[model samples]
Target: MANQTKADRAKIFMPFDAVKGFREALAEKERIIVPKTELSEERKEELDRRLRMIHTGDIITVVYFHDGEYVKLTGMV
Candidate 1:
């Protein structure tokens, strides 16, 4: 044991996962699939107006959908 390298000792203490891929499968199943909402004409116009108001060097926040989720981020433009 004393002669074993650090890498060898680390490998000996590594946990054994018997249910490989189970966690990922379970998370996929548990995830809620939300249907994307369609913007109304009035809503679209409002959004367009707000977008045009933004200019360079402005700090803003945006909300958008990605990969089955709605994400919001704030940063400088």
Candidate 2:
């Protein structure tokens, strides 16, 4: 009705978060995390040698485990 104020009309359109905190819980569930890897002395040496060979401007791809799955990122070093 023309007599209704904006605040009164707005109540009809108000929304509620019925499933509050569920999305946050789902986000926590899907968030990627992995345990730190332990490298053997020989393996560490090999990786150190490879890292020392790269220049600052070189491009490289890093592959590692996240939540037990391998994730890759490509970028310039």
Candidate 3:
């Protein structure tokens, strides 16, 4: 029998009013995840299409904030 292992996770932080800068940072690392807005049906469809490509065991890094204060970053594999 084979043994199963859990994935890894991480968290980081960046400035809030630095959206463009954030993208530049990701680009430099050769990795990124741009969020898709769900403002309309068309946008939702686009997001769905993009998300469909994501799969398990794939690494995902999420950027956000805690208590709407400091910027919070996290990653899952």
| Per-candidate RMSD, Å | 4.4, 7.9, 15.7
Which stretch of 10 consecutive residues in model 2 shows the poorest summed lDDT?
A: 62-71
- Per-residue alpha-carbon lDDT of candidate 3 for residues 1-77, written as tens digits (9 for 90 to 100): 13433332222233355465777787657644455332588866976786787787877654443433334465654
In the range 1-77, model 1's lDDT, one tens digit per residue, is 88999999999889886899987899889887777878999999999999999999999999998788777899999
Q: Which stretches of candidate 2 lie over 4 Å from their true place?
A: 1-24, 63-72
Off by over 4 Å in 3: 1-38, 62-73
Local error of candidate 2 at residue 2 (angstroms): 27
Count of backbone collisions in candidate 1: 0
By TM-score rank, best first, the candidates go: 1, 2, 3
Per-candidate Cα lDDT values, in order, are 0.90, 0.85, 0.55
> What local lDDT score does residue 37 receive in model 1, on the 0 to 100 scale?
79
Between which residue pairs do clashes occur in model 1? none
Better of 1 and 2 by lDDT: 1
Q: What would the TM-score be for candidate 2 when compared with the true structure?
A: 0.48
